[model samples]
Target chain A: MTSILEVNNLTKTYDQFSLDRLSFSLQKGCITGFIGVNGAGKTTTIKSILGLINPEAGSIRFDGMEMNRQEKQIKNRIGFVLDEGYFYGMLTVKEMKNVIAPAYSSWDEQTFSNWIGRFGLNPNQKIASLSTGMRMKFAVALALSHHADLLIMDEPTSGLDPMMRSELMAILLDFMKEEGKSVFFSTHITSDLDKVADMLILIDGGKILLNEEKDTLLDNHARIKGDSRWINERTRPLFLTLRETPYGFEGLTHQKEALRQEMPDAVFERPTIEDIMLAYVGGAEIAH
Target chain B: MLINLVIKDFMLMKKYLLFLVLFALAAPIVIASQTKDDSLLFLMPFYLIMITEIATYLQVSKFESISRGAAFICATPYTRRTFIEAKYLFVFVTFVGILFAQIVASFLLPSLKTGLNLNAVGAAFLMVSLLFGVLIPCQIKFGFDVVRWIFFGLAFLIPFSLGPILRWYQSLGIHFSFSLPVSQTGQILLMYVFAVVITFVSMYASIKIYEKKDL
Candidate 1:
């Protein structure tokens, strides 16, 4: 599959933190879930891709074009949905649409209006009055209306309730119905990705810990449950993570069969994306 | 794209448009009624232009503060340079709009017409342009918060200190005078040329600053 975006050796630094030579690629026409904990540099990476922030080193290429050389053209084909809608509070939805519509060369008035209506947004209502969910809906409407080939959303579903998140996922799925369109959705909600994401990328501490096909990532890892005594120096390295709770001990591993052979009484089950992610990040936090 | 951004700013300013128009008309009338010299009323347009310019500059920051609109705009296809260009255009267009209003209102209100002087307006234009020329880039580079302090000095402290400076000069018994060596038209033309040059310089600087900004 062709990559829609190729980020190579990306680096950015701040007083408090730094993104150290991070790298990843988003495949064309697929939903890539960018899963990371809070302050894992997800937003920073997205911002850098959109040229909102400059990186000290590395290159970002979109559709085989270097982003720095053709930022305007690259951006024209991208629709970005920030966590919160950014619009003038004083203007009504209709006025706001008029203001933003001209920025995109492929802006479709009918599409904009249709999405606005479908989202149940009042054209005459002020943007400031909209709730968080409504604001996100408005942002999605704008993104879809622009005829963009790529939608890069930063923590788009962070604060949303389950119902609202599902509704957003539906809109995104509908958007991807057209070929050559893809979505880079960053969120902490792994369950949402389990439903729709074809590829998974897990970032922690400004570094990519895992990047693979969603099914492959799940298939390679298993959740293992057994007595706390089963965790020993000899077997501990075999488990991706070995943690003990009051009830017993459980861990996750890619070599589930090998570990099963060693601990015949242990229970081994298929791992979810969340389980794999937690095993990697949750273990690191506790170890530190 | 730039036009769309400019329109958005205009729509944002729509709420204050009517109030500004009324103020522009009523301000000259009130000032002229107090002054014996009708020619002094020519300052009305200049006064209106200055006050409105400052007010509008102040309002520019409000657009981005709402919903983090700056970030939103940055996320769009428009470049940072384009965003800054739209702002400069917005300032220029708004100035032109006010200038047109002042001229039209002057025709309708006889007192303003009696006081109108093309050279004076032209001079006011130069000063206004120079003020914003310095301000726009600073606002773009450091953002509204840091620039607001600079704006406070420009808007209030400098003007307020002038009175004390003049008193101190009087106490020292010092005097200064200067006469224009050129005709009224020549002076007006010179001011316009200088204003245009300053505006471009400011714009270039703003674009450079904004391009490096990590918004």
Candidate 2:
């Protein structure tokens, strides 16, 4: 599959934190989930991609065009939904649209109106009056109305209830039905990605820990539960993370087949995305 | 694209603009009737124009900061250069519009007609342009929050210090006087040219400052 967005050696630094040569890409027509803990450079990376912040070093290319060299043209084809809705709160919905629509050459009023209706948004209502879910929906509607080929959303699901999250997921799934469309969704909520994300990129401490297909990643890692006696020095190195109780021990490992041969009584279960994330992030913390 | 950004600023400030217009039309009439001072009549309209310009400038800046609207706008197809250009253009256009409105209103009232001289127009234009020329670059460098406090401080400090400063100048035993070797029209033209230069320089500085700023 062709890549829609690519970042190579993307680096940014603050006094306290930095994005240390982080890199990732999104395949065309795929939903890529970007998962990281708070203050883990998720917003920094997204801002770099969108040209909201200047990176110390890196190249961000969207659809084969370099972002810095062709910023206006590149931005015209990209849409973004920030964690918080950064809209003119004083303007009514239609009035705000009037300001924004002229900025995009491909804005479709009919499509925007359709989305407004579908989302049950009143055009005359002030933007500040809308609820969080409604604000996010309005943002998505604006993104879609501009015929954007790629959507870069920064924690679009944060602070939303489960039902709103589900609705947003449905919108993303529906948006993906079109050809050559892509989404780069950043959030710590891994459950939302389980339902819709085709690819997952996990980051921690300004570094990318894992980038793989969701199914392939899930298929390769498993949770192993067995007696603590089986966890010798040799076997201990095999598990990515281990937890012990008075009864049995539970651990996470990617070497499931190797572990099974050694400990035949061990139970193997499919691990959720959250479990995998914790194993990677928590294990890294333990190592540090 | 630049026009769209300017229009957006106008839309954001529409309510404030309405209030400013009402004040511009009604304030002078009331001040002239109450004070019965012709000089006050002249100063009030120009003062109102300056206040309108400053209020609009500060309102847009504050709104953008509070709403994070700058980040949102930069995310659009508009470039940072375009955004800066739009702001300068928006302020310039607004200044001219209010000045024209004040001029038209002056013709209707005989009491204010004497104040509408070429020197008055030139002085008002030069003062406002120079003030914004310095202010816009300061805003770009320090951010609106810091610039706002600075502005408020200067507003209070200048009037309060003027008397003492003049006394201190007199204590120096220095007298200042000047006569330019030019016609009144030529002098006014020079003032206009200087204002334009200051404005462009300020705009260039603002664009340079904003281009590298992390939103």
Candidate 3:
């Protein structure tokens, strides 16, 4: 399958933070959840892909075009939503459509209005007065109105309420059903990704720790909740990030399928995206 | 792509432009009424210059820290090079617009009326004001306030630095007189052409600097 967004050997550095040789790809007709904790370089990686911050060493190809060489042409095919990309405070919703629509060649006014009705947003309300959820919904609406093949959203769900998040997920899920469109959404909210993302790319401390199909990342790995004896017998010593407590110990392992038959007493549970992420990136807290 | 970027700038500017245009047009009127400092009327372009730069800030590169959170323009099909060009050229075009408006208004205002008196020195200064103040630093620094503060602060020193020049003419009793070595029409046309050329040169320089800017 052809990838829609391909990042290769990317590296960028600030005085305090660095993204080191990070590489990943998102295939068309798939949604990739860019999962990471705070300060895990998810925003930085997204910025690099958008060409907001020039990567010191790397190449990013969107729909098979070199981002630097054909930047204008490449960006034309992409849409983006930042966590705080609030619209002009003075603009009304209808005014926003008038102002921002022309910037894209394929902006469908009818589609935008349809989304507004779907989200139940008023067309005449000023942006500054809208609630946080409303603003995020508006951003999503604007992103989709433009005929962009790839959509990159950075922490788009951080401030939203649960219902609104689910609403957004449902919207994005519906969007991915379209054949050529793909989404790369970065978020700390793992639950939002749980239902929608086909793939998960996890990063911590400026490096990619895991990038795989969400089901594969979940199914191949399982959480074992049992005593140290079970862990000692069944755990893959290389991959176990075990958390020990006063009563007992429970943790995660990549080789859970391999260890399951060996220790029948240990309770091996199917993991969520959050469980696997917290286990590795939270290694110090969970490391036994 | 450049077209969309320009329109985006216009969209962002449209939000703040009302207050800016009013402030630019009225500040000198307020000064004229309060102090009757006729010289203040000549300073109207300076006010226009300030408003143009501020509009560039609000419209174009508003953020000092580059984050995915605040990045909208940096994420667009507009390249960093084209981004800076639009800002610089927009300033140039705005300056010309203001200059033309001033030329027309000078004829209409009874109290503040005077024929335009642009000479080679005045023309060069306009170029310097357009480039050194508005264009170069914006391209180099890439933040609105950072570039504006540095350039305006230095420009603020120009009058003070000229104290010695003012003192020399006073002390020597040797009067200085200046004139462009051309006919009135030639001078006016030359200055207009110079403004156009300088604007483009500075615009090109801004594009070059922006293309090389490290992020």
Candidate 4:
């Protein structure tokens, strides 16, 4: 399968935070989870890919077209749903539909209406009046209705309740059932990722820590817990990141079987996406 | 797609902009009772207030505010140059629309108790164009907040202490009166055209600068 989006060696720097040579790609017809903590350059990476932020170096290609120069061509097929709805507050949903529909050559009015009905949003409701969840749903609806082959969303499920998130996941799953549609969504909600993402790309400290199939990542990274003293070289075989506490040490590593053989006292457990993510992003404050 | 978005922006602006323009027109109608130089009284305030609001609307986006930062506009398919060009074009079009409306209003209404000067309308258009041309570049360079401060400082400082500037203008024998070598119709057309062309080029340049902006 071809990559729908490819970000190559992307770097964006600030006085305090820098995206360090970030590179990743998402294939068509898959749900890719972009996991990162706040200020971990998750939004920055998305912004860079969207051509919202001009990076200091590297390039983004969509369907093999340069993002910066061929933005119109690429954006035509890419639908983006930011965390919050970006629309005139006074505009009714109907007005938004009327206004935004013409911009996409393949925008489907019927599909848009169906999503609105599915989401139970009043088309006549002013955008300012919609709750955050409803607004997000509306954004999702718009993102999906434009006949876009690739959907790039930022924290879409962050504000959603569990039930709504489940609904959203179902919608995404149904969307993927059809051919040639892919979604790359960024979020801190690991459960959502676990539920829907086909692949997980863990990012922290302005860099990609791991990019692998969700199942493989889950299978390989095991959380081994015991006393801090148990974290010996024999157990530290090709570990990804190590987190220590006074009670015990939890090291995320793919060498679980070897470590288990080495230390019979250690308890090895399959790491959830959340556990692995926490291991990468945890600093002094979070360990508590 | 950009054109469609632009249209959307205009439609959103419709209610507020129409209200402002009508209110400006109504001012002269309400004050037709004034005994003074009704033409100057009617034209100046209408022009100034309408232009101020138009500029402010473009600056502040009275419709809705997007918190994703201005970078959002940059990330879209349209480049900064094209984006800025669109804004410049929109502002000019708005200016022309206001001018056309007022011109029509001037004819339909009872005499300003003082007749309107076609010349002042042209001058006002030039001033409005200049205002946007200068402010948009400053806005592009300094951002919305800092530019607002600079603009406010200049705005407050100029009116309070313009004696020297006024004197310098007097020294140059400059005047607003028609008696002082007003342009011929062809020259007037040329002057307006030149002003518009200059503003457009400036706007185009600003757009290019915006395209390269880090935001």
Model 1: fnat (fraction of native contacts): 0.84
Chain B TM-score, candidate 3?
Answer: 0.65
TM-score preference between candidates 1 and 4, better one? 1
C-alpha lDDT values of all predictions: 0.84, 0.87, 0.72, 0.73
Between candidates 3 and 4, name the one with more favorable DockQ.
4
Candidate 4: which stretches are off by over 4 Å?
A225-233, A236-251, A264-268, A282-288, B1-7, B10-15, B31-82, B110-119, B150-183
Docking class of 4: acceptable
Q: Write candidate 4's Cα lDDT for B1-215 as tens digits.
A: 45655565676666666666676566555555454565565565345545554553554443423433234344444445555666666665666655555556556664652334545656666666777777778777776676667767877898877988888888998667554354478666765786787698777768766666765
TM-score of each model, in listed order: 0.93, 0.94, 0.82, 0.85
- Estimate, for each residue in B70-136, the C-alpha lDDT of model 3 and write its tens digit: 2465566555666666665555555555555555554545443422345433553465455544546
TM-score, B chain alone, candidates in order: 0.87, 0.90, 0.65, 0.72
Q: Which residue pairs clash within candidate 2?
A: none
For model 4 chain B, give the 10-residue run with minimal summed lDDT. Answer: B62-71
- Model 1 sits at an interface RMSD, in angstroms, of 1.6
Query: Candidate 1 lDDT, tens digit per residue, B30-106?
Result: 77668878557766777778888778867767656544676677777777878888888888887787777766776
DockQ of each: 0.70, 0.77, 0.37, 0.40
For residues A85-131, write the lDDT of model 1, one tens digit per residue.
66777788888778777778889999988988888999999988988
State the lDDT at B150 in candidate 1.
76
